[model samples]
Target: MNVGEWAAVIGAAGSLLGGGGFFVARATVKAARATAAAQQAAALATAAPAQQAANLAVLEATVRRVDEENGALRGEQARFRSLLRAFAWTVDRWAGQMHRAGIEPEPVHPLVEEYNRTGV
Candidate 1:
């Protein structure tokens, strides 16, 4: 072949090689980005369960504390109800005593009469 023809052939071969190399480089970059994204997703997937566990633990602790407070409030309410009942009984006894001695007693409060009726 002539030198000029040989040079043309070499130029064509170099262009084809350069173009193929550029495509290969671009594909490699795309694959690398995909791998990086997959790794980030995997890391987040692993951390999600741990974060959920932490949140659940906090919720359980809050529930336990609320239960304890509820128990204390229940006890206080029972004590207050007992005192109220005792007061109502004393008022009834005083009114009975005054009636027996022929003295006119003042009327009992409506709330006290309702409590006596309901026995609640």
Candidate 2:
């Protein structure tokens, strides 16, 4: 073959080989990426259930704690109400005693004012 024809043939062969190599490399890279993506997806799918279970356990624990606290607060409220009732009864008895002793009933406001002034 003539020099120009040989050059043309060599150039065509080189272009074909390069194109084929690029195609193979592209396909390999694509396959690797697809495999990595699938692995990642599988990992996430497996972890999702575990994460949800953990979250549920935490929520249940919180609910139990809240329920215990609420029960304690309810008991405290009952005791406070009982103490307030006793205080009211005692105050009524004292007022009755003052009335029976012929002492003029002082206004509760004066006693509160005096206590505030004394800081006692």
13-106: candidate 2 lDDT, tens digit per residue: 6568876555555555666677779999999999999999999999999999999999999999999878766776677688889999998777
Query: In model 1, which runs have C-alpha deviations exceeding 4 angstroms?
Result: 1-33
CA lDDT of each prediction against the hidden true structure: 0.81, 0.74
Q: What is the C-alpha RMSD of each candidate to the true structure, in Å?
A: 10.5, 12.0
Minimum summed lDDT over a 10-residue window in model 1 is located at 2-11
TM-score of 2: 0.65
Q: Provide the lDDT at 98 for model 2.
A: 92
lDDT of 1: 0.81
lDDT of 1 by residue, 1-120 (tens): 644454456556656887655555555566667777999999999999999999999999999999999999999999999998898889889988999999998777787778889987
Q: Estimate each model's TM-score.
A: 0.67, 0.65
